[model samples]
Target: MNLYSIAIQQLTRQHMATIEALVRQQPEFDRVEDLADRLRQAGVRAEARYVPAEKLFIAVYGDIAQVEAALETLCRLNRLNCVPGSSSWQLVHQDHSITQPAVLVIHL
Candidate 1:
């Protein structure tokens, strides 16, 4: 796990036992952060989170071409395995467990 994950866990375990943030399943967050990391490595600005939803989404603010490329990369890396969705951001999967979700805040 990354420092981000560890830190989040510690904070929640110590400070947020109740409902303070949206938690996700382990594999779900894993894939999300992994996708963010891969995108960063590819020089694409992106992240994964749910502002107030039930699933994670890769929030991107780059050129359309770059975003498309990043999405393609995610698919190739087996990250974006989202089923055919009826939402704005199709999720890789939906697991609403209470665990720290990987939220990559890529500061522009």
Candidate 2:
């Protein structure tokens, strides 16, 4: 009975978590699309986007273990030499900052 209860508790607490990392790359770097495609092929839903000179957000949403595994694969494939947990997210845009919708905002 004790073992069964423990197992149930563990199962109940299982939930999905998201892991994000800013892909800091230079103008010459152009592997965003390829990386996103590879991650999708590996069964991980990843979004690799470049918001201009700002940050390249790479977000993976899945189970904790799966996310960790995907993150590892991402690092291995991308050759990210930075330490883990070293990067943090920063808000590049705010709702009040821009009055126009993103579709209307055009960049040169």
TM-score of each: 0.48, 0.41
RMSD of each: 11.1, 17.3
Per-residue accuracy of model 1 over 18-108 as CA lDDT, tens digit each: 3434352556667677777787788877776655444555666666566556656665665333333222234342344533343433223
Model 1, position 65: C-alpha lDDT score? 63
| True-vs-predicted CA distance for residue 89, candidate 1, Å | 5.3
| TM-score: model 1 vs. ground truth | 0.48
Candidate 1 local lDDT, residue 62: 67
Lowest lDDT block of 10, candidate 2: 99-108
* Per-residue accuracy of model 2 over 5-48 as CA lDDT, tens digit each: 99987766652211112223332134545555665777876666
